[model samples]
Target: MGIDSTEFWIAVLQIIAIDIVLGGDNAVVIALACRRLPKEQRNRVIFWGVFGAIAIRITLIFFALSLLAMPYLKIVGAVLLLWIGVKLLQPEPEGQGHEIAASTSLIAAIKTIIIADAVMSLDNVIAIAGAAKDSMGLVVFGLVVSVPIIVWGSKLVLRLMERFPLVIIVGAGLLGWIAGGMTVTDVITREWVNDNASYLRWVMPVCMAVTVVSIGKWMAARARIKPAAMIDLADNANK
Candidate 1:
């Protein structure tokens, strides 16, 4: 659907929101992968890596928009978005160190960045595609703007997460809302909503967010308990 400037900006904001919630991993990966390099090579790798990821992600979003033209894909994407939202709400699991030593040549640095980003970016690609829908301009705009955020905004996100963890949760909920919105727009779901037509547009998104948050909390609680129980069992054996 054609949108005016206000609507376009609104869509862009939503896309940015989604990227921030889901894109933190990009920064970490970039930093870690380049950490082993010498100072000069490290900076070069990070710059090229971020650049390659932006280009790759934009292409993926374009393909995703084209794919959405097919029936039922939107529903599948919505369900994936629901999963993504719940995942975003969960605590990030500690990642293993993959830091490699820096390279000497610019080509080596660029290759390192491109290869690492290629391996790490499937989720980002899919999420961006689903969020942008058929709007190629929005997809391009979102990717271009978000690249810097993904690369340079690591410190900001780290500081923010330290200061206000709830911000991430809100981001998670936004994804759920976007998912629900996309679901309602699905050809199958749209037909159903048209028939029911009275209230679902709002209800669906609310329910999706609630469902994701509830499940995320439950899972988080469960994860916290398992280790405690294991510790208790070990203590009992020692006694």
Candidate 2:
């Protein structure tokens, strides 16, 4: 695809959107892994780690595209994506501390960053593959654009998330929308979806977004209530 083509740009935007939405975990992993490194070596570890991650992600994107070409695999991937969206809406688990040891060794820090990135990037790989479809160039271009944001601007993104928690909610809803889109595009269901549920092309995504936000909000409220109730019970018992 030519760089000037509208389709190419659209694909690039889609990939960028997917990367940003799904990249929070990767940024967190990178930060956590590199936190223990000496200041002099942290940047080196991040650079190499992100470089390795990009290479691995490119390979995985191709592999994911091939795997998603199968009849029912898109459906499976959509379900996984939906689950991931719902999980994102929930509060992060407490006390899930990393066991990574403080290391001044550049190699050790780099290895940690790479390994963590690889493990954390499965969602990103699948999502980006779906967004890029058959366009390898779009996949590469999008990652190239997003990597700098993730590597250099993660702190900014994190601050935004903290300041406007709604961004996370919106991001989760977007993932649900993407999941809905992926579901209807499966080869096995595509014809039926087109014929019988054509409106679902748009409706499904909206519904999925709403459903994710509503369910997530409810779950988060419940979580907050439970902790408060426990504390109240403890106070009463003490009295």
Candidate 3:
């Protein structure tokens, strides 16, 4: 698709939207992984990390495009994305920051960023693949455009997450929405979804968002309760 064409621009916009939504988590991981490096070396680690992520994401996008062409794989990917969304809602484990802080070596930090990017990018790969619709040019262009955001946007995103934790919840819900959309649009299920449940193409995403938010909030509440219960037990024993 040429840059002058409407379809190309639309595809580019879709890719940009997908990358912005999905890239936040990756930015967080990169920042956290690099936080332990000396001030002088932190930027270098982040640069390499972002570079590696770009390379891996391009490769994965191509592979995902091919794999998604197969029957039923979209369903599997959708299911996995839902799981990832739910996991995103869960509170970070205590001492996780300390664990990251212990990796003081620049090499280790860069490695961490790359590995985390690879692992966390499944949703990104699938979503971008869907948006790109097998157009490699669109995929590459969109990703390249977003590279600066992924590289330098981490601090801003991190601050936003700190001040407005709801962003994380929204992000997770977005993933759930994507997962639902992906599930319905899969080649294996598309016809049935279109014929019998055409409304689901829109409805499923809303339902999935609600489901993710509700479950995540419930889990967060439970996590809070557990600590209170433990404190109460300790008070009773002390009494």
Candidate 4:
């Protein structure tokens, strides 16, 4: 856990990567929540809101790191990571809108930001905790470094996601890779895995990543079909 250690830097990079992959929606939420505020007050709201949100997130990550030490919690976390990764890979349906309420007052705006961050960052919490590997220093450093990215680099990241899309796919796969490792390292399974199936450490990442992509693509296809089917039914009724 020394700062000079390679493991430490890797954890830091992982935490920051999680932030970049997952923080765009939160930036949007902040913008929406502050839309009603005066220009002068908007920055203040974002500052305090992000500060509060980070504190809450770090606390949640701490709790998660603790929970992960229990027998089956890491397995549950791994499953959740798979679900989150698949969700990330799925395309948003057209015309989707965030129904966030804009606030006029400073306190209300901050409150809105805090609430939105808490709600939106559950997946973030788990991902960051997994990356931190119980290192509070690394968690703090990574999150602190990522704040500017979340605040200032929001538009850039969103644009990248829209243009390439492969960025998101790669990020999702990274989550699966983390989850794959987590599953084998769980307290309930770790000893057995290490003794009986050491190879799974390297193999599961590929399996989980492919599984997430395949399931996500299938769900997207099904979603597209439903809309198309509805359009066809409407056409028949018109005829």
For every model shown, what is its TM-score relative to the native structure? 0.76, 0.78, 0.77, 0.78
Q: On residues 1-239, what C-alpha lDDT tens digit does candidate 1 reach at each position? A: 46766756667777787677656666766776676678987887788778777777766776777776677887787787778777766664433324555555566656666776765455665666656656777777767767877788677777877799887777777777777777777766777887877388878879888888888778776555344333343775786
User: Which portions of model 2 show Cα errors greater than 4 Å?
Assistant: 1-14, 96-112, 133-137, 225-239
lDDT of all predictions, in order shown? 0.71, 0.73, 0.73, 0.77
lDDT of 4 by residue, 1-239 (tens): 89889978877777777788877667766777888888888888877766666676667777887899999998899899999988887665644435545477777778888887887567888877677776777766766765776677667778878898888777787788778878888898889989999999879877987888788778877667354333343775786
Question: Total clashing residue pairs per candidate?
Answer: 3, 0, 0, 0
Ten contiguous residues minimizing lDDT sum, candidate 1: 224-233
> Which is superior by TM-score, 1 or 4?
4
Ranking by TM-score: 4, 2, 3, 1
Model 3 global lDDT (CA atoms, 0 to 1):
0.73
- Name the TM-score of candidate 1: 0.76
Worst 10 residues of 3 by lDDT: 93-102
Candidate 2 per-residue lDDT over residues 1-239, each given as its tens digit: 67788867766776776677567567766777778777767777777777777777767777788898899998898888777778777775444334646655767767777776776576777777666655777667766766776676577678878888777887778777767778888889889989998998878778877887788888877666345333343775786
Greater TM-score among 3 and 4 belongs to 4
- The runs of at least 3 residues in candidate 4 whose Cα sits more than 4 Å from the true structure, single-residue gaps closed, are 1-12, 36-38, 96-112, 224-239
> On residues 143-239, what C-alpha lDDT tens digit does candidate 3 reach at each position?
7866776877777766877898877787677667767777788888889988998999979878887887788778766665355333343775786
Over 4 Å off in model 3, which ranges?
1-18, 95-101, 131-142, 225-239
For every candidate in turn, the CA RMSD to the true structure comes to 6.3, 5.7, 5.7, 5.7
